[model samples]
Target chain A: MFERVLIVEDHESVSNSVKQALNDLGVDNPEHVSYCDYALSWIKKAIVTPQPYDLLITDLSFEEDQTVQQITDGVALIRAVREVQPDLKILVFTAEGRLEVIRPLIEKLGINAYVRKARRDTQELKAAFEAIANGRNYFPLQMKRSERNGHSFNFSTYDITIIRLLAEGKKQKDIPQCLQDNKITPSSLSSLEKRLNQIKDEFSFTTNEQLIAYCKDFKII
Target chain B: MFERVLIVEDHESVSNSVKQALNDLGVDNPEHVSYCDYALSWIKKAIVTPQPYDLLITDLSFEEDQTVQQITDGVALIRAVREVQPDLKILVFTAEGRLEVIRPLIEKLGINAYVRKARRDTQELKAAFEAIANGRNYFPLQMKRSERNGHSFNFSTYDITIIRLLAEGKKQKDIPQCLQDNKITPSSLSSLEKRLNQIKDEFSFTTNEQLIAYCKDFKII
Candidate 1:
């Protein structure tokens, strides 16, 4: 029953659907903007007014356009908005499925709900809205399952650093120099070899190529 | 309006939305399946019956589960269905936004229409159905624009081959041996160096790393 809602999304179709969902939920005339900057300004302007938006529904990636924008994406916009309105209920509606990308949003940004823009999204959106209205956080079931499975093999920053270097086409021998340059500890050849071997064993990967491919496929790198 | 519609999507929310859209369009009792194998069986069985599904609405990716499936993904399912029912209209309803992945479904598979699973997708799905029912093709507006912009810099097979190797951490000089093993012409170190330089110059990339990163970002390699 959140009456005042603001939508930040680039796609007209998506925004239209969100509006329709809000209307169906008895939340009338929810305001919407295609750009993050405009969304910010509206939120800022509404803060001084008697009527303020209590909820924000946003998409993560916005298609780049002719207009130059300081706040180009939803993550930045969310961060900025949190500074101004600390108590606003925020929901992310996006097509992004990567756990690596989404984990930080919930852990760091403290979003109230995340409903992926997929089939039966209207239902999902409504469910998320209901949860948020009742002061409960809503996360998709699949994400929870992924989190449980993903916890089995934890990827440390050091692991990501080495894997990212390998993905960037650096050979095993060349990684030590890059790591040393970055002032990362234990940059010796033997240490790097040991770490790579340990990681590969954990993942049951035979070679660096498989490990790199797996990382890329999972968006870990 | 198309009467008999078969929706092949793993996510219950998405399938429900598609059903809702189809119901709104006056197409009642549309069959739904969570697996591609089941979808194919349904289609195959219906083919012998008086009423076969006229349209196949499917998503590209399916969550892997305990059930073993021969036609694991939608692309394989599409290809399999094409063999049995060539005239049945196929509309790809997927979250995939990559031009490379979508282009093939249009050009090679000759799918009747494509509706991305996004905000306002119900509207788009209906619109796509209408177009396909009228014997026309439907491609998203952004996709058409991307096609126009994408035509400028074509990534040939040779370009992709070299870039993929580079992404796998192959050095420039080391590429000659890989090319030679594959019996690819111009396997000499000088030829590879020349090709790499030429491609970088076309894209205005100062280094191979930039070229590799660009290819990865755009899913060219």
Candidate 2:
């Protein structure tokens, strides 16, 4: 059980719920703040005190309000907190489903756990807390299962370049020229077409439009 | 308290949590199923029996698996269930945040309550259950505040058409021609520009790209 915890979330109901969940988990009287700047300041002041907060539960998106903030969202808050207290355990509880939005938090931020604000989140929260307590990193179960089932593809730099161009509303014929301008190898129109086809085939997509949409949804481009 | 409740959620962990929440709320031994079709069948069977399910708790999205379901998602299930058992109280528990996706459930389907699966959702769930039990429709608190604050814009069909075109990678300069082809009123480029600007100003977005992204994120298009 965590002795001290801080929650960063804008929604009052959500924050209250988090506090209740934490209390149920034996974390008594956890502190909460609505703004990221306030959370950062609290963390900064606490680190110099005799007892520091052990865990941070934060939501990724914060509704914009009248108060101007240097650290506006959860990602920025997490980064700032990491700089000040690198060893503090962080658990992200958010409704954001895009892989592009979530992948960086785990890989780059070195977060202890990632819990989606979805059905049965309390159970997941308890599981995440236990994992962190035992020095293990907890990720969403769906992501792990999908990765294991080969649903997550390894896109090459060339593949990503082509997909990104398409996402930017570039015509198929215009891609080869852009690739040639960038000095990427095998920049011919035929090679580009073949590569696109190969990538689509790997994902069982019938059209380039579907491939582009999938890439965007997954945040690959 | 709901004496007879049925939970339709795909995720095992989420379903278990929902069951636990129901149990805590004094609904003992609530029935649950992973697929929408199975849930529909269960409801159909239950309705014929002496005791009918009084409340239905469902998740909006179900991950695609080997099970080929006629009613795949929660929305469709709700619609189907409504047709068969019009009096059954329905409570949607999902992580979907887009207003575009959620508006229809409330406005068209006439769902009893909507609880977003986020932080402190159990509390919301209890509130929703109580509301439905008392014959009052319950919406997410954040949505209620946003609506009261005038943050929810009422976009007309014309607005959606323009935003959808932009989302489909259509160029701004080429939009007028598409509008003319479809015989939409005031298909002039200047009117298009004026309307686009008005929308941006309403949301304080400086660029068309930002507007497009906002619309997409909120599922407006």
Candidate 3:
């Protein structure tokens, strides 16, 4: 069990429900901070005495809309808390499902675990806690980035144009004309097709057709 | 074509091959660095001026294995670069395919693109560049954190036990006794069933029987 847990969330209902859930699961001494400044105060207090929480459960969004500190976002707050104690275990239990939010926190904040609020059931939280305590990492659900934007993975700008043109039903020969107008040569076009096929294989898709469809469905366009 | 490119690769042959590819594509102003210090030097220079490169292509591992600089690792490098220049385009062009590597990088680094070197085809790089320029992000192929560990997505620790026991043909009533003896309780069991249903929706398994097969195929036991 986490010796000292701090909950940094703005939603009173979700925070209270979490407290109740922890009690039901037999976790006591869990502290709660509903705002970033208060959390900062806690961080300052923890620095000298190391009241630095053993495990920090935080929602990614603490935007405080209509409040004074509306500019402070989730990633910035996480970084502030991190500056005080670099070794803290942070479990981002938030609703922000975008990789733009999730990935940067993982990269910048040194997050120990990721739990999506919408998809995760009760026991998954316990699993996340246990894993973080034991020095393992966890990511509950990942909605791929490309799907949201229908973008191709590791693709060049020309490749994007080609994919779009291809999706619009242009012939491969017609693609070279579009490319030649844009400075790509016939040899470059051949190399491009071969490489696109290879990238397609890495994604486990049968053809460029399947890849484009998956990308579009995910909104990676 | 990229006006000024920065390459953060360790291997000479691979870097040169990629450089050749870039040259073939008419991008000739690439600044190549096999070490972190040199890369950081270029980074400082880029910040001082506009940039030596418009895009940065980096590998996760570096040669000489620079000591104590966060720039030694690809994730750390992305973080540092992002801290200094929040909008620099970073394309991870590497072979580090693990989710622990890929997921965190995607989550934290805010990397604009990813292309596994071993998996690269001529067209994929082109595609990645195009996507990034058009303000899109890319991830190397995604692997669920649970799947890599041979665990079922919906199964908590008790669910795993129950699944294993069921797979071994244990009776339903006997299962509760088995769990009870092991400190797993009723609410946990209910939550487990609830979670299974959620996963059922996610993977379109439709039936409990199919869920069991999925668990088996994933080697949950």
Candidate 1 residue-wise lDDT, B15-114, digit = tens? 7667767888889799899899999999999999988889999989987766888888999999999999999999999877777788898898989998
Per-model lDDT: 0.82, 0.80, 0.64
* Model 1, span A1-221: residue lDDT tens: 78789999876556766787788889989998989999999999999999888999998998766778999898999999999998889999987766767778889989899987654577899999999999999997877656665636778899999878776667678889999999997899999999989997887765565566557656777
lDDT of 3 by residue, B1-221 (tens): 57888888665534555565667677875778776666867886778785445788887865332144545677777777777777778988865555545667777767888775432333566668777767787653434432455323445675676656654545444566677777876635565577656766777655444445555444444
Score residue A92 of candidate 1 by CA lDDT. 94
Off by over 4 Å in 2: A9-35, A62-70, A93-103, A115-127, A139-216, A219-221, B9-35, B65-68, B94-103, B115-128, B138-221
Q: What is the lDDT of residue B91 in candidate 2?
A: 93
How many angstroms is residue B121 displaced in model 2 relative to the true structure, after the best TM-score fit? 6.3
Candidate 2 interface RMS: 7.6
Tell me which residue pairs clash in candidate 2.
none
What is the descending lDDT order? 1, 2, 3
What would you estimate as the lDDT of candidate 1?
Answer: 0.82
Give the alpha carbon lDDT tens digit for every residue of B1-221 in model 2: 67789999876556766776777778889998889999999999999999999999998998776678798899999999999999999999987765666789889988999888655677788889989988899986676544454445778899988877765656677889999999998788899899989997888765554565555445565
Q: List the candidate 3 regions with Cα displacement exceeding 4 Å.
A: A63-66, A141-150, A153-221, B1-221
Q: On a 0 to 1 TM-score scale, where does candidate 2 land against the true structure?
A: 0.63
User: What ordering of candidates by TM-score runs from best to worst?
Assistant: 1, 2, 3
